[model samples]
Target: MAATAATLALDVASCLSHRWSWLLFALPLLGVASIGLFRLLKLPLGVQPGSVVEDVRNDDRVPPALAPAALVGTFFTVLGGGSAGATATSLAMASSAASGLGRAFGLAPRGAKAHRLVHRGWTAACGMAAACSALYGAPLAGTLFALELVRFDGAVARRLPILLGASFVAWLVAMPLAGGYALPAAAAPDPSWQVAALCVLVGLACAAAGTVFGWALRALRRAFVRSPAHPALVVAAGGAVVSVLVFAFGWQRFEGSGLTLVYAAFDGTSEPFDFAVKALLTTVTLGFGFKGGEVMPSLCIGALLGASFAALLGVDPSFAAAMGSVAFFAAAARCPLAAVLLAAETFGWAVAPWAALAVFPAYMGSTDVGMFGRGLTGRLSRAKRTARDKRRREKER
Candidate 1:
């Protein structure tokens, strides 16, 4: 259902873009409309994709309204040409539905709070796995993504098989409806030390890019929070900026999730600054209270940046692009293992080893808190405080 909603929204947007080109001028109005819908539904503004997953991981009860609110919000945001992806929407919807089902089934019996919490976690994980698998068309990657995103705690560990089964079944059901998201196969690079070294450089570059992207998103959200203007005004202003960008860059190049640009990078036809443009636009669209996921934009950024790196270093653009797509997402999301599996599933296992090299460097070099995880800076500070306290106690003893 989430996939269908996304597909239908994109199809409508495409039709409008081609037939009613003048609608570009009314983007601000559309943005206002999206926010208005959310406001009418009494949902909070700037609800991010990761927040829902975070709630599930923390074993917080998922609100029944979250699924519909997210779907409606994402649909309108994309319809207005916001830089967002539907994968997050799918995850949100599925997880919320799972939570609702658990409640209906009385998964939490009296005096069994611990049992209820575990049940909630695993059911949400299963839903997430199914949604991701159906959307990406990679059941293994989808399953691993759910596990990694939620962290492989005891609760998740006990229910691993169930999650995997859910993902596979979802993929099987969605295959005919949405099809797998497959990229063109690139020739595997020869295993040479020089190529391996270059992969490290690519990873570092992408990690840096990921850091910047995360900072930009946080900065924008902070700015929005601090602004004195009404949210409607802020949203309208964001839409206006997006309109200008669309007019400056071809609409087709910046539309929807920028998957077209990803394909272009794979084909070695992306512009030099495609990544920069996407990063900026995505930052603006998402930061200004738009509802959508960052996963696709992250992949888009990595693919374009990798393609550019390949062009400069005299390497295979497709191969570099494939690596960048996975490495950058790993750095930004802080999920290297899942990313490696994603690389293997999408680009064939032949690319897995090189992808690992890129992924780890990107992961290690990443400084900013990832898009989905809790703030890394905060985590580091807490750790430092804990160590300091421990040392003081030892000295006193």
Candidate 2:
């Protein structure tokens, strides 16, 4: 159902972008309005858990805004060349709906509030796993992802069964509805020291890119975030800037999730300029308070980088791209295990070692801050890190 919903939304956006090219002009207004309206309604925005779940006044009760906020990612991002991935969007929406399921299902109000809240969290976890599995078509990765996202809560062991059940059912349901490109896979290459060594280099390069992207993104967000301001104005201004960039570039390519470029990278049809441009556009989209997750954009960037550098690495373009995308994305999200599994599961079992070639180093190389604001924790911006380092240095002195 989640996959179907996203496909339908994407299809609609594709039609609109093609049929009424001028609707692109209205995206800035729409982007700004979406933020203002959702805030006015106290919706969660659902792009990040910090934006929703953390806002619940009562720690025990689910936030009233979770359900509505989940929808915001889909609606806000699909309307134009905007950033955010279906994976995060689906997870947010499903988790939220699950959180509210107790009230709808009337699952025994006889239980204590704490018990009910526990049930809701468990349910949300399951929904999150299922939604991601459906979107990514990798059940284990999806399940682990859900668990990893909420690992900080420390209830992982108790809720394991519930998450597994929910993810299994969701994955089964999604098999039919998910109708599009699957992650490409390959068999592990002949084991070679050279391959292992190259993997390290790949990881380092991708990590460097992730670090730059992270820092640049933080810098941009700081300009608007550090002030008392009307969000709509800020978002609208950002949207307008994005609109101008899109028009000037004459490529809606930077808009949306930017996933197609992954395939294009494998096929050698991609332009050298795509990675940087997409990164800039995505940073702008999110920096201005445009709502959505950063995974898709990150994946696109990884694909572009890997493919572009395949010749230099003396590897097959497809193979290099496969490693690059996995490593880069893993670094971007700071999830080496997830990245390895994702690469192995999506492309081929053969890609695991090579994927690791990139994944581990990428993780080690990238900063502690990730694309999703440290995976469910408060953001630690570059400035914050610098300031902290400075204070530590003074103490040492």
lDDT for each candidate structure: 0.78, 0.67
- Regions of model 2 farther than 4 Å from truth: 44-65, 68-73, 102-120, 179-181, 185-187, 375-397
Clashing pairs in 1: none
- Over 1-397, each residue of candidate 2 has an lDDT whose tens digit, in order, gives 6544765565567557657667677767778767766777775432354333332212244554644554554466557667555666565567666767755776425343455344445556667677767777777777776665554354443767767777777777878766423665444657777667667776787899988988787666766566467767787777788878888978776667776777788777787767888888888887777766577678888888877776665656677677778888777766667788778778877777688778888887788667555643233355588899999999999
lDDT for model 2 comes to 0.67
Q: Per-residue CA lDDT of candidate 1, range 296-368, in tens?
A: 8888899998888887777888998888888899888877888888888878889899999999899888874
List the lowest-lDDT window of 10 residues for candidate 1: 108-117
Question: Cα miss at 117, model 1 (Å)?
Answer: 6.0
Clashes of each: 0, 9
What TM-scores do the predictions have?
Answer: 0.91, 0.84
On a 0 to 100 scale, what is the lDDT of residue 135 in model 1? 75
The local lDDT score (0 to 100) that residue 226 gets in candidate 1 is 78
